[model samples]
Target: MHLSEMTPEVDTHTHTVLSGHAWSTLTENCLAAKRRGMKGLCLTEHAPAIEGGAPSFIPHSQQMLPDTVEGIRVYRGIEANILDHENHLDVPPEYLRLCEWAIASIHSHMFPEKAKKTENTETYLAMLRDPYIDILGHADDPSVPCDFEALAEEASRQGKLLELNNNSTTAHRPGSLPSLKEYILCCKRRRQRVCVASDAHFHAMVGNVRPLMTLLEELDFPPELIVNLTQEGFEGYLRERITRLKNLH
Candidate 1:
């Protein structure tokens, strides 16, 4: 499907100035989401592990934001830092429990040592099995390498969504191209679900995942496996997540 014809129902990973390093305010971010025809948007500020990430109070107070902003569903979440190979996250479990969803990532800036493929694979597997994390962010970033096939298999088994970040091409993360293609191909083989996100640091970039979507089309990736392609599909994804969370609690 064409990008214009199939805009993702939710731009699942977005950020605001509360993240400190990002430029846009939360209102600006929400306005951009509404203008882009997105049915939902998530303000997933970077958790405190990063130098300029949000303070602890941010996630705890996110309940104050309305459930919907400018007619778009808004979710308060965090891009939590993966502190080690054993799936430890920067945000505490109680703090994580306050958000609607969470995306766990391995940031080389936080842990500069390059991990072996086995170590990286284990990290992804452990994070996938965690109860709080709903999505895995930018596993394609080359600086933090992993065994894509192994991660994809585990992600599939755990019902977690692996991200195809648009900013991986336009922004930092230069060495992402080869691994991105490989991981998507791996997901295709395993029939795993994936989410296309802008990983937007600014308001204008929200819902701007056209490049990733175009790549998906070129690969002839199965549309049914992409959860955010349509509103109903995304709501169904949310319903499934809710069920899982309820069972966890």
Candidate 2:
């Protein structure tokens, strides 16, 4: 599907006011997504990895969110921080269970430079093996330094989606495009699916996929393999994911 033909670019990874560092409120984020013609936006706040950063282990109360926003579904989710050596997140299983979806990712602050590249890949692979994880956000980030082929294969095997993070490509981390491209190619070769995320920290950044789209074109990626192209297909994928996660518990 061409970018113009793609309806409702669903941003599966986004941060809201709940994320201590994010600048936008839930309402503002939703409004921004609406303006961008997004069918839905998942508010994935940071699962704290550092001290005094939204409390590393506490989960947000889901009852605090409105069920819907401007006719678009607002999924309560979190970008759970991947700790070193272990695939453990700061938030507990009960907290993760409250979310409609969950994205596991490696943030620079969480994984220090001294960490082993192979061990980092192992951590991600273990997370992918876990049925609770729906998506692996920004798995190709060079700072974390993981083997792209292995991660992509595990994602394909487990039916978990890989993320093409646009923000990381643009400015968050420079010189990582090669790694991201490798992930894209690996996913393509493995016949795995992926989602393009803005990984937005503010409202204006919500639903922005220009960077990711351009990269996909440059890589000659198949649009049909991305999950956000159609609502029916996306939901079907989500349903299967939920069932898989539930069975794990």
TM-score winner: 1
lDDT of 2 by residue, 1-249 (tens): 566334345778888766788889888888998887777888788877754456553445666767778766787788888776766777677777767788988777657742578888888899988777888888787777888888878888888888888876787778888888888889888878988888888999888877778778777787889887666667778788788766876
TM-score to true structure, per model: 0.94, 0.92
lDDT of each: 0.82, 0.78
lDDT (10s digit) by residue, model 1, range 118-173: 78778888988887888889988888878888888888888888988987766567
In candidate 1, how many Å is residue 160 off? 1.4
Model 2, poorest ten-residue lDDT window? Answer: 50-59
Clashes of 1: 0
Residue 62 CA error for candidate 1 (Å)? Answer: 0.6
Worst 10 residues of 1 by lDDT: 52-61
